[model samples]
Target: MSWSVDNTADRQVECDSVAKQVRSWNWIVGGQYRLVDMMGKGSFANVYSAVNITDEADLVAVKISHEGCEDTLVAEAKVYEKLFGLKGVPRARIYVKERRCGALVMDLLGPSLGNLKDYCGHFSLKTVFMLADQMISRLASLHSRGYIHGDLKEDNFILGRQETIDERTVYLVDFGLAKTFLLTNGEHIAPKTGLNPCGTLRYTSLNCTLGNEISRRDDLESLGYLLIYLHRGDLPWILAESVVGGDEKRRLMADIKLHTPVKKLCEGLPDEFFAYITYCRSLRFDEQPDYARLRLLCEVAMRRLDYEIDGIFDWTIRLRDDLEWKRLLALEDVF
Candidate 1:
């Protein structure tokens, strides 16, 4: 199925029903986490907003696998462990396997870039540049750890909550599809073909759609598409959504992305955006990406536009205004 936003009210109703059933059993995970509400749901797992009753009631996200899907959660937890202490990666508190399912507890984060984009339609160039800098840094860290985030999409990158030191920091989450591209001996894995595409079709790389084995370059290519989407609010291949059949749709998307000129794709945006995509798509299968240079492209764009490297983002301003409005309403009620 295509990646579309579900009706929030309907989803919440279903989540509430499941929450009630789980609460009735008085299930306490990680010895002290009590699931308070459902935060999100996936094909094989559901994420709950929980509180650590034994740790000063700190909030955390608890991901529990559905029946017969325990292995997925367990494997994802292992990936998180490998990414521990890495900037932009969330810390996994604990992972436990019960008779029925597996659960992983991690630090809670705020709304995703996708959610913020939906709230504001699109992002300003300054906001996109700031995000590009952090996102490239995050990818560089993951690549250094020998892992590649196979799924690089807007929904996977979220900001830290407000009124905290991390509020300006962006965190990458959902590593269930992450894979190691480097072997133990420090050699890169050889490229292979005839593999099924593994990420969201909208942001997946052209190489991936062509059944080629995913590598570091493919990850970077996907990130380029994501940045473009964030700036323009859409992509050229979005029309492929109306096509019937998953395989046919993917084929059409790949064709469009392959034939679409970089100049046309990044039309109306800064030249750096076009250059970024061109560089990513030009890398060899096993070549190491120049992460530093990639980040420099964004910096050049920011300077050209006369935008400061300030931590303030479009969403930051919007969120601040929202909070102030709420405070005013509260004072009016009190008076």
Candidate 2:
């Protein structure tokens, strides 16, 4: 649906009170949604396509789990509810029902970026910068609220359609590992470990591998790796080769963390795009770049790439509009 300012108010929902315990949640099936078919499967849950029974016109992705994972399921539901309709990301249309079979409902997304890459091979440099700009803006929005996406990778991003560039929308999905940064008297501290290093290994940065403190910087590192994969069809390290506690893996990661070969991979991209990727990879435990700087870079790169890609004759605009962007960024100030 075309999200406009008129419909934006209807999208905002309170996210404070969701079921915290799974055993306490009642599993209700067939209440308001008719299961269409299985969409995808995760390590813990099965995502399905379903038509909302209450609103027959609406279709959603429902997650079902019946293992000893009630609590985790409930936690994921709560996070999605709170984060649904969040700007720059795919807003979750989440609801929990109590019945014989419990279910969690979320908005459906099209093919993920990983799948897109698999089907279409590599994308142009212009598309990479545009996507990178969108990602940077989304990350900035999440970080401003002190919330870490926890998982950032190609699989979590979806393409809305395959038409013109302006018609395509990159929807950031899956927030099962998301967490809000809690502040005590205005001080920001590191998120504790044991939070399940929640991200794809291929895209995960060295900070996560080292068990170093998790912060916004960790997400940025992964974003950088994703951009590289999208533009160059390669990750900084191979998953099988980058396992923790392995000698070769550790050494290779150490070298990458110390100095990522930005010049080599970003061979044909614009100078600004290279600079942004460099900044993302360079972010350290104590020295993550401020969101303001990243936002500025994204804006500049997006505009530059737009001119280069669109040229003077073509007037096809990107699907992502400024109003939604500005409104989403405004959420940070309130936080």
Candidate 3:
């Protein structure tokens, strides 16, 4: 999970195939990362793995964008800066290299769940349990702080570095579509009636697709889809082909989400899956979800599957030996 290396002239980008989209942003190239290697691109931004010059064993990830996309990165940087001291989120200290181009730097994260899924198919039950617990806890933290991660999908949840205490941790990245669903005074934002689409299509909530303003419930609902996707590797409503227009496709997705029985979607999964969907669906537009209950539900599933709640996960399974990390530190010594 840790990406520090000496003479990183070619430290290599992980998940190159799945995260191949990259563009050259010509600002802040000499600072931050000693070697700015492209990690991958998301729906709207490019990521890079750069060596922190002070320490080869310690590297930082820089996310940059240019032109019209600059504002989204600016907004994302603001969210990271504003949420300082917020655990489970990424590094609170975000540095801006070129404010005009939205070039920014923060602590590097491990592989995204999206890249992992594409490489290894569905996550194991143990991975899902660990991810589900962390995700719900983080979602609760974000909501408690008065923000909705308008975009909640596997790609946004990246693993923490192996060398850090957050090794078992999964940090939720990309606050591009984040919004203050609740006002400063604890009052909800004014309700709207229309389809103002937001976030990724696969995991967006029905309310957001219908043009309604997203709220806490919308985020939790999206989390529901994320959990299912992690469990099954695909959602039931994901169409086989784009036979219809974008609007129509979303309509069918939303309809199938509504019409399809929760039991069917969660056929081979545990009871927690159904509970999550049912609870998310039943939430009033302005209500708070029971974060503890949802996480506890996943805990039950973990027990049913005979997985150790605190066991190391998919990525860290190889680093269990002391020699692995020792070898990494040795590389630092030689450098």
Best by TM-score: 1
Instruction: Give the per-residue lDDT digits (tens) of candidate 1, residues 1-335.
Output: 23333344554554455566677877788679888887777766788888888875599989887766688788889899999999889899999986477889999988889888998888999999999999999999999888899899988999987688998899999988888998889899999987778878888899998778989998999999999999887999999978867778878998998899989999998999889999999999998899999999999989989999999999888888999999999999999
What are the TM-scores, per candidate, against the unseen true structure?
A: 0.92, 0.70, 0.82
Q: By lDDT, rank the candidates, best first.
A: 1, 3, 2
Q: For candidate 2, lDDT tens digit of each residue in 59-86?
A: 7777765443456677766776666566
Each candidate: what lDDT? 0.86, 0.61, 0.73
Number of clashes found in candidate 3: 4
Regions more than 4 Å wrong, model 3: 1-32, 97-100, 240-244, 318-335
* Model 2 CA lDDT for position 332: 79
> lDDT tens digits, residues 204-260, model 3?
777776667788888888888887888687887777225345666667766877677
List the pairs of residues colliding in candidate 1.
none
Which one wins by lDDT: 1 or 2? Answer: 1
The TM-score obtained by model 1 is 0.92
